[model samples]
Target: MKVCYLISAVSSDNTGRGGHYESLKILAESIYENGLDVEIVSLGDIFPPTFGNTSVKVRFIQFKKSDSLIQYIKKVADEIYDISPNVIHSFDNKSYFFARLANVKIKCKLVLTKPGGPNPKLFFPRCNDLIVFSQENFAFFKSRSRYKDVNVHYLPNRAKKILCDDLRIREIKELYDISGKVILRIARICDSYKESFIQLINLVNGLNDQGFSCTAVIIGFIQDQHVYDEIIALDCKYLRVVTEERYTKNASALIDLCDYFLGTGRGVFEAALLNKLVFTTISSSRYPVIIDEDNIDELQHNNFSPRSILKNRTEASSKEFLSSVIQILSDEIKLNEKRKYILSVAKQRFDISSVMDSYMEIYLNCFPFKRNLIFDIILNSLVVLKVYALLKLSKNKKAKA
Candidate 1:
């Protein structure tokens, strides 16, 4: 069976860095390797080089600013019809919207993989199947009355073992002048993470003040220029921010070089697969929780994010969190044990091979193609208006601030 993967380059910037792109790349490559026909349909200017040397076909349908939404949808629908895929899987909400509307012309099974957190202003389109990465999201969707007839799959973000070249690792270390114990953070440098970035800098300073030689390296795409500038302006000798425009090396390679990983979402699993001690925190978290034998199950349930656990668990304060990390770093035996356990758990839970198998099953299962053109048009109109209003409100609030 042929599968066409839909990605929205406009929404994601086609930067080749975010979790959605990474996950799609891994899944698509695996599907192609399994001898099934796979094609990636990008609705923007150009696809990122994340595909690397893979032979999978990538078709770019550039959406011009002058084109109306309906025109773009028709254009995409024509392309998908030409590909004649049995299953069209979309990664982002925008792509899913287009695919849902386009499917009216071409009646094919549709799948949507919800990548980010829930949006209050947006509404999900009905599809043959839906996949969510976090357990909290999966449970919430599964219990929803609207999705009683939909097939909701709970699949966590996956990471495969990546082998980093020794030469490349040495070059990255020399370029960053990394020394002593390294705490690495990989995320998008946006307004949501501004407070977390500041907290991380302070934590590094505290670690050094406590007589531990430590350096913190942050590698990420710069989404908000103001936030990125604010983070860069902070005077911290122990901190280094590697913007995406500057660093082009594989992120997993950096994880392999780090002694501890500091961040949340898919990066937690990526770092764990590399045997790095993973510490997870949400955007609003004052302190991070270390993932070890005792808390791995709980954390994994929430996709290693403390957002769901904050209400029930009393988290450590800034000082207490730093002390805990320092204590772990100082004890070699404890740190080694934690690393081994994390690696084992990562292999068992996030192995890409198993994830691929699950996806294959979903793709092969036949699901009826159903659509209500009138209801869909009304639903899409309301969703677009709500999104527009939300954006306007956000801009007003930012201007007032």
Candidate 2:
């Protein structure tokens, strides 16, 4: 069966960055490998660097970010009409709404890949299936009355082993003149993940005070300008900021250059595959946990917290966290042993082929619809009319005032 994938933005550039784009790339590759027809549509620029001469049809449709819902529906509906896919899948709320609007006209099964915690407000009754990145998210969604019968599956975020070399790592290190220990953190710098970023800053500053040479390489798309500004204001010599597009093409190689890895979510999975020392701060967790074989399963199943943001971690916890990091960095033999175990776990669980198998099962199970054209038309028309009426009422009130 043919499938069309829709996302708000493919990447900071066409090649792509971030978990959503990476996840989409893997799933699309699986679809292609299985000999299924797949098409990708992005609201923003779409020439993904990762797709790299693949057969998937990737299209970019330009639209104003401020466009109204009706405008968005029309634009996405036009594209969906052309693709005529059996199933339309989306990755975010806006795209999910776009898929629903398009489905009204074409009767395609709508699937949402929920990468974070459940948002009841974004729930749509017409969605056929949902794939979540963590068990916590799956259970949360499953418990919702609105999603009582919806097919919700817990699929831990997966990352295929990435090839990287020490030579390339050194080249990057030399390029930046990072002479001391290289600590890397890849995440979207924003308020929601304030604890991680703040902790990274504090950890680096604290280490430097103890005469330890260390540099924190912060990478990822900047989601909030204020947060970005705060990071810049730190003016910590050990801090080096890099954009998502700069190293995403060879992300593993970049991670290889690091003496230690930080951040949470999919990057943690990638780091483990690369056998880097992974210490992460999740929203749900009180402090950073260094990933090891014993806790990897629980960490993978729970993933990162979606909504909670620690205002600030406690001083005692901060001191304990710093001690753990220093201890790890000081022990070369123990670090190597941990690396071997982490790599083995990654191979066993995060293989893309297995991830693809689960995805394929979901796709095959969702049958194509024999749509009631009249009912769809009536329902969608009523929705549009209700919105229009509300707008008109507000305009009349403004005019009278």
lDDT of 2 by residue, 1-401 (tens): 88888876533322234567777766786777888899888764344454453457887765443455467568768988999998887875556656776776788777788765445453233456888887777777788875665688777777766666677566667666777678888766667667788767777887777656789887666667899888889798888877645554546556777878884777776787877877776555444556776566566655744333334434356566667667767888888877777777767776666777777778778644324334544554554445434544555576789
How much is 39 displaced in model 2, in angstroms? 1.4
TM-score, per-candidate, Cα-based? 0.87, 0.78
User: What would the per-residue lDDT of candidate 1 be over residues 1-401, giving only the tens digit for each residue?
Assistant: 89999986653233445677778877888899888899988775345556543568888887554455567667888898899888889887667776776776777788888875653235666666888888777887788777777798988888777665567556668988987788888777886566667767877888888778889888877878998888878879999888654354456556766788886767777788878888776546655667777667666666765353644566666667678787888999988988888888888888777777789889888484666546755776565444434444555576789
Model 2's C-alpha root-mean-square deviation from the true structure amounts to: 6.1
Model 1, TM vs. native: 0.87
Could you say which candidate leads in TM-score? 1
Off by over 4 Å in 1: 11-17, 49-55, 119-122, 165-168, 244-249, 306-312, 315-320, 381-401
Q: lDDT of each prediction vs. the true structure?
A: 0.73, 0.68
Give the Cα RMSD of candidate 1.
4.4
